[model samples]
Target: MTSDLFDLTGKVAIVTGSSRGIGFAMAQALAEHGAKVVISSRKEDACTEAAKQICDAGGEAIGIPCNIVENDDLDNLVQKTKDAFGKVDILVCNAGISPFFGPATELPDDKFDLIMRANVRANIHLAKLVIPEMKERKDGVIIIISSVAVKKGNNTTAYSISKAAVDQLVRNLAVENSPDNIRVNAIAPGLIKTHFSRVLWENEEALNKRLSKVPMRRIGEPEDIAGVAVMLASKAGNWITGQTFFVDGGDTIDI
Candidate 1:
């Protein structure tokens, strides 16, 4: 079974916010690698479409829509996955929102609350919901989609702060598990060209400014982060836990 190091055959995965962008790419990759994956997001239609793509590719997948901000939705998501797949082997908490973009000092309380609630608090809740089963099996992988903004700093203070807290969250969970078998980690991507980051990469001037700092001299694509998630979820990354893997194209290192 040495060749099975990266093989995910028969594993069940729940990837939140997987209707598009990084989440979709990771789900697709996991499915392709033989894991049964759930395509989930706020929009049922979008989730269905994403799931269809995976199934069409000869992968096992299902669509389950869930608004990550709602605790009930989170519960339903896990329950739905268990109902369909019998067990959860991997969980990707990739859904998040950043409603405001401005000076940290000027950030309004509502937006700050929204940002933290969506990005940080929600992940904690989802983890709480699924970790018990993982602990019982003594095996699991949780990957959080974080951002390089956590390290480089950004004008959008609330979003940046929330991601920083996520890195710490991964650390805390990984440490508490202490090589017990449930691995919790994160992926910190930089300047990816997706609808979610259009403001930073859409304009010629803005894109060039950000690209100049990246040693790779290019922005990342959703696929760029997908491979890392696959490795982490597979046995190849069993030894690694509670660390933030930077897929930043040298953005964090250049500085």
Candidate 2:
């Protein structure tokens, strides 16, 4: 039936950077929709807390601390998920870093490298590591969490470039994996109200300036992105692939 198309029962999902904020919200949403979720982050304590919150909500989740910047950590995370569950049915490459906030000229080279490694390289690494297993099974879904800044050419030059790379990564992977029945997509969110974007949303003057561009006339919540993530990971999106969905509350449209 139509309702069953979105059902995710028995599926196993791994959401990186899921200790809190958008990642946690997406993990919770997947769990609520009947998927076993792995909540991972750099801090074990934060991961544990997120797992507990999901469990309390009557969903199955396990905390696994993983620093995406480290390949060994990512390998351990994949191994632990296979050991704990059976397989990884879904992967949300949401772990990213944005340490700098100025123009590209003023941004430090080290910081720029950090952003490239964490936001762009890590996502490709994780996807490549998981592809063999998914190919063997001939089924899987990979979702990359991108930013609307890529489209708007935001002031965070390094971050925007990295995210744009992620968008292309999704497209390339989707093309490569489509014949194998694996789907890959990216979600570019606008100004979502989260700790990650607190500096932008918290400032009254900046918040109003940002809001004026969005026809929605408000900021987005983690839940807003979470729902879309659920849709992409479930059977409802089986026919969808190679797309960069802009969940920007009309910000991209206005600009």
Candidate 3:
């Protein structure tokens, strides 16, 4: 028999930015756990391709292209999911951008705005759109994919700040939604080796510098964060909310 704590059968999940990387990994993990998932990204072709892969693996999935920065796109995404799957039991706000790279003082205004809009504002928009249904049913889970940079205070100032905002967003939503039985939390991941962060792990000097700081002595994998997403979406994490769980291979704890 399936354990009640982690059983996700019959659940419907909408995972944004899931065409590739960590977002795709989380969507796949949720599907494997029996949740009918909506795989979404900006590109329609990529979303369809990811959905096909999940279906081939014997998981129920659908593709929905959404650019999170647009309100109409996000609304359409939610509408499409509801229209296709009936209801959404889980919402993974994983679509984020980190275009700016440099010291805080050197950061450009446009890049800063883009990071905030994509990472912080987009997350808030999606959560607002999903929470009404979750509240009415008194059942739902919202998982935000944050970054360990908030804890370690990396030189990626704009990115770190945006993630920190997301962390606080989780806490705020969790506190407000607890009475409705809707849970919200965040996963702060360390240097995961994904296309989004290729600049860090692909560079020899940068990779070595980052590796030396981690107790695990190596970068993380996309699957590393995927497992945590599953746990949070499952009943195993029902009592957990309003917190940021760091999945950084002890990187934050190491001296």
Candidate 4:
């Protein structure tokens, strides 16, 4: 049963910031493959709507609002998921913030701190919440959504640095948790057409400049990253761990 390799029946997954964009796509795909998914974001209304859409499509899903920057909210998300599904088998730290875009030298201290907290520290906290149970069960998957921004120096210094930090975090966590059969990995996307990336792709000149570097000659859709996430969360990727996959349409090849 080749298809069985990717079947996620009985799996429980929590996807942060899943109200829309890449996170929503991944959550929908995971549920379609038989995983019970939790759709989370800062807004309760948005989360509820997204979750309802999945349910209307015949998938098991629920929405739980969470602000990644808040430790208490992170705790509640994990706890609520357990109350709903008993255990967590997959966690996607897809929520991130890039509120600042400027030269590294000119980045304000407050903005830099906010980026690190939301993109880096918050992920660590969420992972810690699920890991103890994962270690006990001897099976788990953690996928952090990174960005191609880490591959080169860019104006978005704080955001890029935060993603690079998570890249290393994936490797370190993979090594530490491998003994427990837990897999940790990252997916770094490039020039994706999402709300978070509207600033880059919405502008004609900026889009052209970015497309020129992308061998694929087009920007990525949220679904482009969703499939990779499914692979990482299922038995299809059972033997894989500690690697950062570049899903950037060959943009990094030239960089």
Predicted model with the maximum lDDT: 4
Better of 2 and 4 by lDDT: 4
Candidate 2 wrongly placed segments (more than 4 Å): none
- Alpha-carbon RMSD, each predicted model: 1.0, 1.0, 1.3, 0.9
Model 3 vs. true fold: TM? 0.97
The all-Cα superposition gives candidate 2 an RMSD in Å to the true structure of 1.0
Assess the local accuracy of residue 38 in candidate 2 as a C-alpha lDDT between 0 and 100: 99
lDDT of 4 by residue, 1-255 (tens): 676988999999999999999999999999999999999999999999999999999999999999999999999999999999999999999999999887788999999999999999999999899999999999999999899999888899999999999999999999999889999999999888899988888889889987998899999999999999999999999999999999989999974
**Regions of model 3 farther than 4 Å from truth:** none
The numbered model that scores best in TM-score is 4
Tens digits of per-residue lDDT for model 1, 79-172: 9999999989999999988889888889999999989999999999989988889988898899998998888767889999999999999999
lDDT of 2 by residue, 54-81 (tens): 9999999999999999989999999999
Error of 3 at 13 (Å): 0.6
Error of 3 at 218 (Å): 1.8
Better of 1 and 2 by lDDT: 2
The per-residue C-alpha lDDT of model 3 at residue 144 equals 91
Q: Tally clashes: model 2.
A: 0
Determine which window of 10 residues in candidate 2 has minimal summed lDDT.
147-156
* TM-score per model over all chains: 0.97, 0.98, 0.97, 0.98
